[model samples]
Target: MNYSATAPYVWDPNFADAPDCLLSADQCVIQAQHYFVKGLIEIPVIGSDEVFSWGVWVSLSRENFSRAADLWDTPGRESEKPYFGWLTTELTIYSPTTINLKTNLHTRPVGERPLIELEPTDHPLAVEQRVGITMDRVREIAESLLHGARSESG
Candidate 1:
């Protein structure tokens, strides 16, 4: 089945009420193309008052989503990191809002399955710093997005 053709855009739960600009995947086109589960998360800091933020935009093919769903219900999905294919691109930082700092991820991968390079590199957020997301949540968001989109289209 063509998942992208069926799915709608899924906004981050925290930013559901916020403007679409702050969302990482708001710019994505879900049609005959790929589908994505996107979210933004605040990086917790212990010391200073400056707020840091991170965003995750995981791109999934229809087949990949099915595989991920199976793995999600399995006991040890965590060990299989990068369970879903992701949009690999630079992390963009936007000016702070009155409430908190914001970050956006816009990745339109040129190749197939460009999993992020996760190492202790110069990147602002390390692999460990990347937010933990479950495959179950991914499926939930996609389903919600698709259902909403279908409702509107009808």
Candidate 2:
């Protein structure tokens, strides 16, 4: 299963036309101040080889952002250290907000999106990442997103 956010949570459509801002399929810069990168928050599926993933964005420091961009097309970029960032996408299916979660963006091979590793916290999303989620949970999330359910409780 896969879900995605097209841009950062703070993205403004007007930024698209601003000379100082940039919005692309895998990267974003708002007002040339806020840097963001798209990555995957993957969860293992219990009893299956399949994985569930959220194609989300995370805000990064200017230095980290520059470093990532410099290595964008470089082979073996996956060996580079992960960049610290804050989760910018809101996964409405989770309660108590899914924004601002701590994350580490691990760059992958040239063609793949970076991997987002959430901090090991008590948050349900983090817990699910650390442990594995069942297929039933995946279906629940899919249903929630597909039906526009506001939160997991719904």
Candidate 3:
């Protein structure tokens, strides 16, 4: 369940900011400078035979981020990567209050965590949920979204 073997992408939340919005409807922000480990992740799709490969975008508060960091640093966390838990939060986007972030820890219910699932791609949230990444090219789309939140915050 861990990606320690692959040295999965891990983010350093030094630059991540607290959840703060000037207006009621603002996107969630990453806060400070974060570092990415750059690796592949397998996303499971509910009720589907296919699994998606993508870079994981961990969106969480500094506290939760710290927890994730600690897990990543664990001696044999790679092979046990999928064990990384979840962090839940609500982010304001567009309107005063929008975007409910649910952590999809391996233990949680399907389609609830931040990682994307394919079976429900038709769902409105599916688009935001899917993020693809490969060894040759690490998709920055998710990171860009993380950055966008930063820009909107200021």
Candidate 2 regions off by >4 Å? 149-154
**What are the per-residue Cα lDDT tens digits for candidate 3 across 1-154?**
1111111123224423444311111112333433222222354444455454443333344554454455543544433334232221222221322123233433122222223222233332344345422322223434544677689798
Clashes of each: 0, 0, 25
Error of 1 at 131 (Å): 14
- Superposed Cα deviation of residue 107, candidate 3 (Å): 10
Q: In candidate 2, residue 77 scores what lDDT?
A: 99
**RMSD to the native, candidate 3?**
12.3
- Tell me the whole-model lDDT of each prediction, alpha carbons only: 0.38, 0.95, 0.33
**Candidates ranked by lDDT:** 2, 1, 3
Off by over 4 Å in 3: 1-29, 33-50, 76-101, 105-154
Where does the lowest 10-residue lDDT sum fall in candidate 1?
Answer: 92-101
Report the C-alpha lDDT of model 2 over 11-103, residue by residue, as the tens digit: 988788899999999999998899999999999999999899999999999999999999999999999999999999999878878899999
Summarize candidate 1's per-residue lDDT along 13-115 as a digit string, tens digits: 5544444323332223233254454433333333344323334455566665555545534554444545334433223221121111132222223322222
Q: Candidate 2, 2: how far from true, in Å?
A: 0.3
